[model samples]
Target: MTWLFNNPSEFAKEMISGFVSANASMVRQVSGGVVRNTASKPDTVAIVIGGGSGHYPAFAGLVGQGLAHGAAMGNLFASPSAQQICSVAKTVNQGAGVLLAFGNYAGDVLHFGLARERLISEGIPCELIAITDDISSASADEIHKRRGVAGDLVVFKTAAAAAEQGATLAEVLAVAQMANQRTRTIGVAFSGCTLPGADHPLFNVPQGRMEFGMGIHGEPGIRELAIPTADELAAMLVDKLLAELPAGISRAKGARAGAILNGLGSVKYEELFVVWHGVARRLQEHGITLVDSQVGEFVTSFDMAGLSLTLFWCNQQLEALWFAPAYSPAFKVGSVIKAPLLATEDIEAPAEESVAAATPESQAVAGQIVIMIERLAEAVIKNADELGRIDAIAGDGDHGIGMERGARAARDRAQRAFQQGAGAGTVLQHAADAWADQAGGTSGAIWGVILNTLGTAIGNQEKPTANAIAQAFSQASHGVMHFGKAKPGDKTLVDVLLPFSEELTLQIEQGHDLAAAWQLAARKAELCARATAQLVPKIGRARPLAARSLGSPDAGAVSLSLILNAVGETFPAVHPQGDTLCL
Candidate 1:
C-alpha cells in the first residue's frame, strides 16, 4: 500500500531531512527534531513537542514563531530515544525553562519521562504534559489513560501561545493542562494505514464497513459497523462527543467550542469539507456555537482513509488563545510578521568516552559475553517475521523489526567492546545502550533497563559468582518492573522475565551451578511466555482490542523467552560446576 520508498530503514530519516530543507526559512534542523530558526526572547519557556514521525504537520510542521520551539521526532511509529529528547531540549531551552509535551502513548511516556528527569537533574528546570484527548481509548472513569488524537493541536497551540506571550513555566503548564482537560476526540476509519515497504496495512476492515475509535498508529478499532452516509457519520461523531462532554461544560446547549475535523491521511480536502457541512449543521441545531474550525489533515496515520473530530470546550481564555496568530509550515492563523532569522550556533560534538577498566579475569570472559549476544542476534533475526506476525494481531506489527534491529546492534557493540579489552560488565553495558538507542520503543527501553541493571550487578572489578549472577537476575526483574510498570500477568515480557528470574534465583540459592540453574529458569520462561497466548492485554496499544490479541503470544514475551533459551544453551559448557564463572 505504501509503495514509494527507496529503503524502508532510511525512510523516517530522509523524510526529516527533506522537510527541513523545504522549510528552511521557518525551521532549523536539530539533533532530535526541528526548532524555529528565529530567536526566542531570553527567559521565555521553550515548548518542545513531538511524537513518532509519520504524523507530520502534527509535530515538526507546527514548529515556528507562535508554536513549538522544537519537536523531538522519533522513528516511524516509535518514540524517540531519551538521548534524542535531551538533545532537542538542550537546543531549545532559553534561560527560563523547557516544557516537554507529547501524546499519551507508552513509548512516548517512557522516553519523554526519562528525558525530563535527566534534564531536571542537570538543573534545566523542565516539566512534562502528556495529552490524553481521545475519549475512545479509555473510559470516563479512567480518562487519564486516554490516547491523544487530533486534539493534540489544541493543546500544543494553547501551550505554545502561552509561551509566546512570555508566560512563566508554571503559567504555560497550567494553560496546557487546561487545554488538555477541555478537549475530547473520537475517530473512525474506512480502512487501515500501511507503513513503508509493508505488504499489507496495519489492520484491515471488512468491505462496506467502518471502524470506530481507531487510533493513529493503525491499532484496530474498538468497534465496527456498516458504513454510513456523510450526514449519518457526522451525526454519529457529534452525538458521541456530545454525550461525554468534559467536566465544567455542564451541557452542550449554547456552548462555544473550537472544532477540528481532522483527516487521518489519504482523505481528500473535498471529502473533509463535505463531512464538515453536515457536522456544522448538526452543531448549530444543538445551539452550540463554533468558535473556529480546522478542516484538513492535522494528525494522521500513514495514508489511512479515516478522520477524527475534536471539540475544545472553550472559556474566554481558551477562545482568545485559539484565535491568536500562528505561523507554521502546516497551520496558520492571523497575520504573522517576519522576524529576523536567528544565527544558528553549532553544538560541540561530545568527546569519545573511555571504557571502564576491568580486572584480568573479568576481561577474559568478555569474549563469552560477546558470543552470547551474537546468539541473541541470530535468534531474533530467525524469528523476526513471526514476532511481527504476533504483534500485528493487535498492535502496529513492528515488534519483530525492532527486536532484530536491537539485537544486532547489541551484538555489534558487544563485539567491539570485547575487542577493546573491556570486561564482561562493560561489554554488556555498551550492548544495552546500543539496543535501546537502535530499537527506540517500549520494548527497547525495557531491554535497556534489563541489561543495564544486570551490568551494574556484575561489576567489572570482580569475576561473576553464582550468587552474584542470581542477584543480577533479581535486579533485572525488579528493574524491568520499575521501568516498564508492568505486572506479571499484563501479557508483556514481564510475564516471562519475572518467572525466569525467580526460578534462577531459587536454584542458585539452593547451591546449583550457574549453567544448570539458568537451564531450569529458561524452561520456566518458555512455559510462561507460551502461557501468554491465553491472556488478554491490559496495557500498551492493544488494550482496546484485547480479543484480537487472544490466541497469540505477546511479541515481547516470546522474544524474551527465545533469547533466554539461546543464552541457556551456551551456558552449560561456558560455566562449569564452580561457583565462579568461567569463559
Candidate 2:
C-alpha cells in the first residue's frame, strides 16, 4: 500500500517534484518531465526514454550521462501527452535528431507515435521505438505484441550507450532494436499494488497462490499457480525464458548473457539475492555464461511484492555496449566523465491561435456546449470507481481516473473558450486538446480525435444543421476507427461509437430533429456497450488476459455510453421547445 501521499490526484505531480529536488545535480524539472543537467557533445543524437510513472529509476532515474538525455513523465500508469513528449525532445535536441524509446504499451505507443509525427512536421528528425521484451505478454510468433518489463533497462541502456558514443540516430535506433530483440523477461507477483489514496489494490492473488507473468502497472497476470520456494521460482523463470530464445540459439550451451533479477517494489534486496543464487546455478548447469549480472530494483510497481528476471543475450557488440559506463540517480556502472553544467535551454511557449469571429447563433451553441461538457464530467466522476474496477480485471486499472481526468479537463477548457467569445467549433477544439493533454492515455488520444474531428465538421460561422451534425458524427466515428484501429466487436469504445454514429445518421436522414435523433442513437450505443460483455478483446492490454474480462463490458465502451447519455440529456437546452433550427 502507498502510505504517504497528500491528494491522490497529485501523487504523480509530487513524485516528480521530489525526484527533481533530490537529483538536482543530475537532472532538472521541465514542463512535463526532467532532463539532464549537464551538457552532452554537440550534434550527438539524443535518446529520450519514458512511459507512465510508478516504475521509479526506470524513466527519470536513467536520465544522465551514458543514459537517456531526458524523460517525458506521465501520470501514474498513464502515457505522457504528445505535448509533453514533444517538449522534452525539443529541449534535449542539440543538432542531431532525437530517438524516442519507451515500453510497448498501447497508451505509450499512441502518445509517442503522435509526438514523433508532430516533431517531424516541426523539422526535427525523430525516430520512435517500442521496447518489446516481455516474453510472457505474447507468444514468440507474435513477439512484436510483447510489452517491456525489466528488459526496459537493457534496451534503454544499450541505446543510450550508442548515443553516448556519438552514434547517429539510425545507429542508435538499430542498437536499441537489436537489444530489445535479444532480451527476454518474465515476472510474477505475490500481491498487487495500491495507488495513492486508493482503498484497495488493483487486484489480488488468492492466499498461497501467485500471479504469473503480471505487468508493472498492477495488471493481473495471465495465470495463477501455487507459491513456490525461492529456488523453485527461480528455476521456473529460467525455464520459461530459455524455451523461447530470440530465434537463433538452438540450445543454451555456451551462450553468454547479461541477467537482471529485478525486485518489483516491496521485494527486499536480500531476497532478490537468494533468488539470484538459484538463477546463477540454473545458468551454470545449462553451460550458459552470465556476464555482469545485476541484482537490484530497476523498474518497479510502487509496492507490488514481486520480482522478474531479464536475460539479455549478447554478441560481441551487444556485450561491449551492455557493459558501458552509465551514471544516474538510481543506477551507475563504471566511472563516466562528468560534463559541465548545462546552460539553460529555452522552452518556448506555443503561439496563441486566433479564433475566427463567430455569429450570435453559433455563440448560443457554444454556451450549450459548456453545459453538455459539464454533464459529461459529472457522469464520469460519479462512475469512475466502477469503471476502474471493471478495467482492473484485465487492464492496468486506470480507466476510471483517466476518464474523470479527461472529462473534467474538457469541461474546463470548453468553459474558457466559450467565455473568450469563441464559437461552438472553437470551444470543442479547445476542449479536445485539453482532454488529451491532461488524460494522457489511449482513451485520451481517441477522445481528442473524436472531438476535434467533430468540431471541424461544425464550422464556427453558422448554426449547425441536423444534417451537418450527423455528418460530423459519421466523420468522428471513421476517424476513431482509423486512428485507434479498433473495429466493432473488438470490445472497445468503437463498439459503441460505430453503432451510435450509424443510427444517428439514419434517423437524421429520415428528417428527425437533432434532439430526437440523438436520443435514439444514444440508446443504441447503450445497448452496444452492454453487449460487449460477451466479447473477447482482440487488441490492447486486455488481449493477453482476454478471458478474464468475460461477463464485464469493456471499460472504454461503457464510459462512451455514459458520455453519450449525458450528451443526450442536454439537447433540450440546445433546441428550445424541441423546435429550434433543427439543431
lDDT of 2 by residue, 1-583 (tens): 9999999889999999999999988998887789998877779899999988888988999999898999999888888877789889988897789999999888888778878988999999999899888887888888888888899989889999999898999999999989988999999999988889989887788899998898886555668999999999999999988988886666788989999999999999999999999999999999998887999999999999999999999989989987799888988889999888766644344456557689988988889888989999999999999998888887877899888999999999899888889999998888887888889889988888788888889968888888888889899999888766788888999999999999999998887778888999999999999999999999898887788899999999999999999988887744555564425
Segments in model 1 whose C-alpha atoms lie over 4 Å from true places: 346-362, 419-426, 572-577, 580-583
Model 2: lDDT of residue 291: 86
Q: Can you give the TM-score per candidate against the true fold?
A: 0.94, 0.93
List, in order, the clash count of every candidate structure. Answer: 0, 0
Report the number of the highest-lDDT candidate. 2
- Give lDDT: candidate 1, residue 376: 83
